[model samples]
Target: MSHFSGIWIPIITPFDGGAIDHGALHGLVRQYVEAGVSGFVALGTTGEPAALNEQEQGAVLDTILSAAAGLPVVAGVGGNHVESVLERISLLNHKPIAGILVAAPYYVRPAQVGIVDYFKAVADQSRVPVILYDIPARTGVHLELDTLLELAGHERIVAVKDCGGSLDKSLSLILDGRLQVLCGEDLDMFGALCAGAHGAISASAHLMPERFVAMAKALEEGRLSTARQLWHSLVPIVHAAFAEPNPGPIKAALSQCGRIRNELRAPMTAASDDLAARWTLILNKVVGSPAGLEQS
Candidate 1:
């Protein structure tokens, strides 16, 4: 479970001239790793894995693995198609991926049993540990707490990315004492940590990994005053990145910080100019100290 905690950034795969910007991707990993993110998530929603082809995904994976220099890389292998997800994981069996993160089926909206079995099948076959992704809004179904508990100790099911939009779920997991809980909601990050969550896996970290890590570490160290100040400062930034859908505000924030050229694939647009400018104000004026990764 320790392998899965802390401020982990669901990295945004940079695009330039209609191609995966490996150079920018490399820079982001380096920056975040230096900034103190415990791990990196490639091809997640922020990375726009849906828009990338298999070859492009493979290439981005290779680039990220190479750039990461040994930080844990959780490949975004989850989707509605279980078979294809399994195939993708099989293809990645040899890669040095820390784990696979798969969301439950969307649109089809399977029963809890089906969702349980779906992840169990993936976990059963995965070469690495698995983090069940419980994003009810995105998946169109919740990773019911009982269902998750049933799957909690299953083979390779070591951790959870619990963004069910509630600290109650996170608290329940910690109380259950079966699985480690990592809060996936930026808005509720401190509350989750306060509720005994181990750490956060937030998209906002992509904008200010240093600040996010700092807030987590402060909370961990019992410095509530400092943590509160930082957390308040962070709310606006988090709000900005999520204003136009994830990775939009984040990518724009990163670009404002000069980390990358803000670009996105088709079907996923970048933030409007107004939002981008607003993100700059939030990042520069509000968040002063960068969140450090090592302490967290």
Candidate 2:
């Protein structure tokens, strides 16, 4: 029943020759839309928002919104500065986004109560729904169980992108039933879904989105045997996608498929030659397999 309940791509911001490749970005969104992704998360971690300036981020989101053709888009808003984050949320409120994904303040490592206050403030400011992004690995501040439960009381804070890396905590959130849980860790997608997570925001799904959508649908429909087969088949590609610090291997695979150029910004390089080769071989096997070709 939740609109967030399915495979959502935290889309990569494609680049070509040191510029934001709007054409490639548009094409990627169209490709995933056709692939039956539930929606997209523009400017999320995968999109490299930290590398782009305000103008570039806005342009990228505009292109994705246009290409989405009415599919829901959740814009990513993150920062340690409360006022700045709220300002970003206010700006996004004018856009046609389904929600905002707000991560905990990074580098500051605020206390749990501070985390609660921050999200509460963000939820209060956001006109659109808010999906809490609980990626402690990146933020260095974990959204402890009690903090999350407290935040769930906010009407606007509708869901969580669960990347806390604690299965017990993730399961607890699902069992609580107040906030919809979307698996943010690609490798745990299956287990999370089996535990009743609403869906996933997968980076690897950029490669075989339809397959991911199918797996989610199968699980939702109670087709356990089919979902198991799909998950088993996807494990290798998932591993390959995250093999080299995100977006690199993902960009390489997309480039190999002729979707986008294998380019990344400064500080984030392209996938290594060896990793690219391995990715090609793995992609070939997966895409060529009957499971990959099967329609949902």
Candidate 3:
């Protein structure tokens, strides 16, 4: 079975008074596991990994793995330096993780060839499967179709978190049939899944995850009506989740439900009051009284 196939939450790192909230983080993993999410992407972009020091990141991953009980967990490995990323991957290879999510070198904006080489080197060094995170909006470089195709040939480079923002390229990757394509964009998930994407690594799945899982399962089982209904119900929450910058709106919604405190690292503030109020209204309408967000 493909490890990447299903709704996986790129979980947010909850904080309490500026400290790593391991208790809340553990609670989240248990909550999602009960929600039936396929797995998790610990320390992914949504987790505010950049704000976490190495020690904090390691501790966060440890809490997630322990709380996940046996579900697969993919650790996020991101950096502009190849050697540093490789070193991190080397360490993660020892952990009981399912795979590593690596993005293109950010800030430097390396050429496609350099991008190809960087991934190849990382894939070679890693013992676990690598999921290419092609989020160009954050990284400032697109993982072009040809470059993606070339990387698909790597045995260890197994899948892609498709955030490249090109439908044609995304569709092409699906058709190629080499690398499993997992939709990274929350809004495009339904279309991508209908077009044959294996699953999604969704940040918004942090809230009301069971619906997301059900939606994915419905589509996979050829129940279009069921999937469409869930998608329509989910659209408002999805839109609101990203209304502000990520993790903020998401954390706010989670906080209101008492899942975690509505706190974020410096430079990444909590969702605005207007957005949070909108989230409450939408949650009430969509899921009925924020019951889904209540502690498990």
C-alpha lDDT values of all predictions: 0.81, 0.90, 0.92
> What lDDT does candidate 2 reach at residue 155?
88
Tens-digit lDDT string for candidate 3 (1-296): 24589999999999999999999999889989999999899999899999999999999999999999899999999999888988999899899999999999999999999999999999999888999999999999999999999999999999999999999999999999889999999999999999999999998888789899999999999999999999999998889989999889999999888888999998999999999899889878876777655843
What residue runs in model 2 are displaced by over 4 Å at the alpha carbon?
Answer: 289-296
Residue-wise C-alpha lDDT for candidate 2, range 1-296, written one tens digit per residue: 23688999999998888899999899889888999999999999999999999999999999999999889999999998999999998899899899999999999999998999999999999899999999989999999999999998898998999999999999899999999999999999999999999999999998778888899999999999999999999999899999988889888888877777888997998999999889767876888732343321
Q: Write the per-residue lDDT of candidate 1 for residues 245-289, one digit (tens) a residue.
A: 877777766666656677888788888999967765665466542
- Please name the candidate that would achieve the greatest TM-score relative to the true structure: 3
Question: Arrange candidates by TM-score, highest first: which order?
Answer: 3, 2, 1
Q: Top lDDT: which candidate number? A: 3
Pull out the clashing pairs in model 2: none
TM-score of each: 0.93, 0.96, 0.98
In model 1, state the lDDT of residue 103: 87
Q: Candidate 1, 60: how far from true, in Å?
A: 1.0
Among all windows of 10 consecutive residues in model 1, the one with the lowest summed lDDT is: 287-296
Candidate 3 lDDT (Cα, 0 to 1): 0.92
